[model samples]
Target: MASSVLPTPLLKDELDIVIPTIRNLDFLEMWRPFFQPYHLIIIQDGDPSKKINVPEGFDYELYNRNDINRILGPKASCISFKDSACRCFGFMVSKKKYIYTIDDDCFVAKDPSGKEINALQQHIKNLLSPSTPYFFNTLYDPYAEGADFVRGYPFSLREGAPTAVSHGLWLNIPDYDAPTQLVKPMERNTRYVDAVLTIPKGTLFPMCGMNLAFDRELIGPAMYFGLMGDGQPIGRYDDMWAGWCTKVICDHLGLGVKTGLPYIWHSKASNPFVNLKKEYKGIFWQEDLIPFFQAVSLPKDCTTVQKCYIELSKQFKEKFGKVDDYFNKLGDAMVTWIEAWDELNPSAAAALPNGPAK
Candidate 1:
């Protein structure tokens, strides 16, 4: 690792980096120093008795799962899929101008050539710098073929080739599903150009939670990570499913989704069998669920995100009325999640800035 110090955030007191973890704060001990002058919210999901060590002068807050369940009440309990599901808790509680969601195992990539480039600093810079209303990561797939699009690349834009997607390069480990690895192994030591590719109006892609940043205003509408995680109906797909819903909601509101830049080094290894087993439920439901998102009815002149979600809940109830209750729970959770956001982030409500330009 390069001996680079954490860079001061441009947003200062206005940014909150939300991470969900069930482990100790060892990663923070090593990298928290880099995210100075910003608030860090750690969602300690399990073993709440084990205290997290917070070094002096670090602006941070730690919340256990029980604490969040108490705060959000029973309606929000179904949303807690696993440790990563804690992201929704962080989202509702966040009162900052921007919310950055990253995994505990993820870290900034060192410049492969041993130069003095800090990827985390670049991510913060890119995130803060005015570009689009939303950004979907366009990082290179280590397992992708020449000119091949990533797995969730929209079929709508596949033929027409839009340019709003940005490409990010990761150094060490890559974030891919287990099945992808079984087909072909990830190559080591790869660098990619940081290009922001434009996404057409109807395009959608699988958004990764490991490294995602979004404007705080979208929190109410976009913070719907549904029933997933260990011991739940499914383990993975909470973030990706939420991403699809968010992209649809964003499109309805005329929000731009940009993909690319500020590459991250994922320090974890892929386990195909375990991941494949966990992915079964989500994969089975996605084929039907995604089409529903694309075709769902929404008022063209939708005034508020809340109204849009009302239609969404109704649609969800209508579509999946019998198969299972996940959709209904999701629908109810969406409304409650917004309410929780309003209740928890009253100051944010007071700051009521106008939505970003469509």
Candidate 2:
């Protein structure tokens, strides 16, 4: 077992890790060695009949759905059955400077130097590095061939101006669109890549739920993964939609999306058949949704990104009224989430140059 691999001592107190899982806690023991300095929040997703058993002396909280609902209140119901939605629960309760969402099956990849490197530490280093105005960049993978952009990266922004959102990529089992799996899936032990990309300004890329982290300061607006996956009406696309919403709002706020670096080895592989089924609706809807999001017109008075997000959802409902009832609930949930976040982080809300519209 290795100790903390944080590049800076300060990160010890600044980062918290969240893992949402339907599986038991046995796999978590592997993480105990490096987690001493950070807090871990384990969200038990399904069949919470048995309690998750965390190793003794670990600073952690194991919460089942009921516990999360209690913390999130009535609006929690809006989140529904999506596992990705659990991230909102983690984000709201996170007390650190940064919050990391790592799937239970994901692990930090070791560097060529044979030293264990923590992905969260690497990402923070990249994120905090002095950049002009704002950061919207992709971390490039050193091991990958050619110019392989992260899937769902917005082509429109490839040449657009620079702007403060960053998204990382995964190795081993890559997180690609379902169509990529039609041929074959990556082997469990596929070689991973390294390197961080500071995506050029004006780039809009989707954020991955697994192995992703963001600053708590932006929590009020970007900390949402809506109703799209984990057995909800839609089988997949929860994080993708959230990413799109985040990018849309980020663009309005002059923020950039950075990808690459802090890579993780995805131990679990999606069954291609299951993935194809899960992604069918999402793949079909995303083409139209992107342009729709681009065309959405926020109110002139819309100040905060959260307000813009609510407006975006409302617009989505109007245009796609017959899409699905859950879509409307997603809008309702975002409204509820923004209100709850404002109440909880009044200081952060006040600090926002454009506070939520009253």
Candidate 3:
């Protein structure tokens, strides 16, 4: 990985941003501003021949399922289940020390005018220094107090509390916690932020792939384990799993994990109304919750990603009752299967083929 310093003068060469996209050409075009000065690796999982409109002077690389399957492995098989293959492509090709992964539907917000580039330059210096590897996650909601959703640090910092940035606040919803506070956004000049919370040494938390950055070295070998057979990719909670894996590796090595600082605006692509309708109609139930439950049952030494699965499972069960009681139960069952697999095969759990340990 090349040493990347934060850019001065707002030129494009300072950072490398990796985006995994499918057919959202307009969204891709809209995000062109964030792709400046950085190498863009667009993983087009569907048609290898499909043309994408890329910005001028941007160095871009395109990859298809065949390429992905070779890099990943059995996990790639999960991509076949989704229309757009999988979301694992971005991590597969990220070669920079500081990699920013954003969704196709989201774009980076531009820094406010009148702020000197020195602020951004200084921010970059802080980011590059060996302080703590901070992961930035965003909360997006138009109805929440202050700015839609909260970003950067958690709402209330309690020990062992799940340090997750809310994706959106579900207002007036019973049985769900409301996100009521907002942290001051880090200098908007940069896309990433240093987190405020802290964890034990070598610990890793599940990072939202939508927009997050950390030293490439800390990510370790879990990327290869996320692959699928047909070269597609896994979907749903893979990012959390990746985070768990990173945590396990770090914990084994005694690295501390922290959260807080720097928040970004995540533009929602799917219609909020339509999604709400689905949720109301029980169409969008979280089926993955089951597998997550099962994942937690694995050995105590299970990967960090597996632990996250368990944590999510507990959250789902505690929040939404039994899966059978709900409209969807398959999601829960899938997580259960993962737990069983890990328990039955401890060796497989310890090391993955093509994963980082090798």
Candidate 4:
């Protein structure tokens, strides 16, 4: 790690760095070069009695399990107790326009050039730059320096949609499913792809929350990580559930989602046997869940993020309730999530100033 470094300019103060963790955040030491300058919203999951400490000097607001129960009151039931899903609590409490969330185990990754990758800065650029979701750009990110739309690209769609989410990737330990992790314990991801592809509208992607950034204003309310972990039957799919819901909402609202680029060094892999127990149900459940998200069509009246999300919750109740009792509870949790979101972030700060053009 560098002795001292500068934070990403202009948006530094306006953006909040959200991290969800149960253990002491010694990982931030590696990120201090890029993150120390910003405000951190640390969502301390599990055992509030156990104090989680951050490195000295970084400005942060730490909310523990007890704090969450107190703050959201009845609505706190929507937040998962001993899971990363509780991280969304940081999202709810945040007043900033941009949110960059990374797991405590993820470290800074270096690009092929051997230079330390500034994942935070790249996410900022992704959020600020336009996303061409309507049409795939052959040359990848047309807005990236030295890149442009191919010859046959449509002029009408060139401006593209406002990117609501920037989904990043990981290097070293990959985010594989439990079965895969168990089978390939020795496998590691050394391939670093430089392109950032906009998830074309109407398509779904498995979103890993380990390293992610989103424009909170454009799609904040829809960014709930769903009800998983602790008392719930599901686990690990917290980010996946949020991604599916958010993607549908973003598509209906004419927003965009991009993935790849700004990779992080995933330093640790969770125990596969433990992960297997948590993921067993979701592995099968997602078979039905995928089609539901694919078929979802938000009504024209459901324009705002909250409206879209509430409407999505209704769909969850109507469609998945019959699938299992857990779906029904998840549906209820979804509604509660919206209620808590609205109650906490009362005034919608939707208008966020864009970063300078590339």
Candidate 5:
């Protein structure tokens, strides 16, 4: 049930909203105004037996655990159930060129001016614009209105790299690590920073999947959330894992990852004790993981995202196998994810861009 009114000239027509949820989607009521027009790909995580209702008028297709098994078949082994990581399944099935993913708990945030912020609108703009990741711009996003690259900024890199990932910020409850959340339970985010900057080349930022958007053709194959520990319900490391791998691949492939701006109101804070237990290993391994990504160097032959990811998986197995047997399995799962991705998206795989993120 779409409105007769045409969408604005923004990147609406080509985009799809992908939400991964276990609970009812009543949170969508607040987003009805902004989300009503776009087609939704709801990846219902957790028990498929449990019914989750969708508000009327939205053009959406809901997929539960049973649907995932039916669609993906044996290749579904690569998909993580009972985890937010399952949202990557929506990315795989999507036929659209652009995808905007938001958490079910996230609500529409207001700017300091009390204006209701349209997060999707800003994400599209970020994706559509060029990102200057190769060189730092002291003046801030030069592509933004009323800003320009300052003196001594290299002219060769000014054209910027094609943005593959657009990472959005959060308001209200900040996305803190388990340790931080455990230490400070009363902390709430109140400041709203209005800026978008490219994650510099060779720099790895912790990517939160909550309010994220990406070009399907460019970096979709590399967007696997993860295949954590043989279907065991793992911790909050899924997006971080994807982010690290995607950043490494993007840096090698000469692409940009942008962040900041288009903040969302993150309402719910999960149990810190639960998060700490799940992310305890993640907290320990994170220190070592950052350096691994920073040191990652892909071969020139690894042109495609799939190839680069496969190489990355090998690196994990080779370097981190002795630390824990899990890396070896995670490495294989990465390859399996690519195989599944190619099986699902044949055309995109066959014609995968080797030159640029476009």
Candidate 6:
């Protein structure tokens, strides 16, 4: 291991992180390793006044969502609890030139080689060089294409392709949607360049709110717009909404959205419902499926999809016998995935490259 060097005080241009957490102290402890080197703002949604044990040398600001809303007005939108914490935190702290938000459950992978980080920095500089303003989106897997579908998108592997964009990686959102149409077979893998990629109007990506970075100037004003009059958040899909807002803003500004370079690994807790079939109802019944069920509003006509959900729910209950049993099974699966990931991608398994303090 390298000698521990204290991260230099934050620079105006470096990425600062904001994390929203609830009652998972264990999860916070696991996240400590990645929090080093960045300004860490933790929003304790469950209890605002609760004091957390943070590692020395790390800067932390704790806030309760409830208190924020009461003090800031309904526009604070810290109401939905978990998701709201993210929204509120994004709105409040984020003082650096650039801001990066990651989920509390996520662990940062080791920092990429200096060359790769430089490449990412250059990519951002080039994207924002145009006369017009622009918004950038973070890349992630299982890319969401809005509210309708959640999966089935190609992943870019070529490192230098300028036109290629990796999911959950990095993107600039324009303020307004462009009249320009998406060119088919969206080009993949090339050196970084300025370009516009299109999705159907109103399309939202399954965003990994776990790891997103953006220019403070571009995202700051937009965050205010997302709040309800009462300070409640209007969109359940903050990342997706932010992405869409960026597109709209850029198109109107004559700037274009570009996707490219450097991949970000999302270390947040897994959503087991992602790929499970209803026939696997046994899985859902045993585990808590309320959130998954609510998050995914699949069409009824999609019988195959419906069946997959039903079966998974049934099997989950049958196999687990109790919800506790289901949780155990889920925990086992997560552990297995983590172990497998460590074996397969040793480099990505390290602390988050740029994340909140411990």
Candidate 5 yields a Cα-based lDDT of 0.88
Q: Compose the digit string of candidate 1's lDDT tens values, residues 1-358.
A: 9969865557777768788887766665556546656788988876767787766667888888668778778655644745487677887787776677778777666554655445445555544433333333254321122334557756454332111112244556666666776676665546655454434456667877787766666534565676666556666687786777666666676554545566667777757788888787777888888888878767665445555666777787788767777667666766676667667776654544224223
The candidate scoring highest on lDDT is 4
For model 5, how does the per-residue alpha-carbon lDDT over 263-296 read when each residue is reduced to its tens digit?
A: 9999999988878777888888888988999998
Best-fitting candidate, measured by TM-score? 5
Native-to-model Cα distance after best TM-score fit, residue 27 in candidate 6, in Å: 6.9
Q: 1-358, model 3: which lDDT tens digit per residue?
A: 9779754433245345556666644665554444544677776756656676665666777667676666545544433323322444554345454445556665334334522122223223334433222332243221223433235454332112221121111111111111111122221223333223343434334455565454443332333223222322223334554555455444343333443333344444344343343233222332453344333332444335444344444454565565345312323533543444354335444643222120
Model 2, runs deviating above 4 Å: 1-8, 131-164, 186-194, 200-202, 229-231, 297-300, 354-358
lDDT values for all models = 0.63, 0.65, 0.41, 0.89, 0.88, 0.37
| TM-score of each predicted structure versus truth | 0.79, 0.80, 0.49, 0.95, 0.95, 0.45
202-291 per-residue lDDT for model 2 (tens digits): 444666888776666653366677765655666657677777787666656555455666667777777778878777877778788787
Q: Which has the higher TM-score value, candidate number 3 or candidate number 6?
A: 3
Which residues of candidate 5, in runs, are more than 4 Å off? 1-9, 356-358
Instruction: Write down the RMSD of candidate 6 (Cα, Å).
Output: 18.6
Ten consecutive residues with minimal summed lDDT in candidate 6? 173-182
For model 4, how many clashes?
Answer: 0
Candidate 6: tens digits of C-alpha lDDT, residues 258-333: 3332333333322323212211433333234433332333233312211222333344345444645533433333
lDDT of 3 at 353: 27
TM-score of 6: 0.45
Which residue pairs overlap in candidate 4's backbone?
A: none
Worst 10 residues of 2 by lDDT: 130-139
Candidate 6 — which residues are off by over 4 angstroms? Answer: 1-15, 23-35, 77-79, 110-167, 170-207, 224-236, 272-358
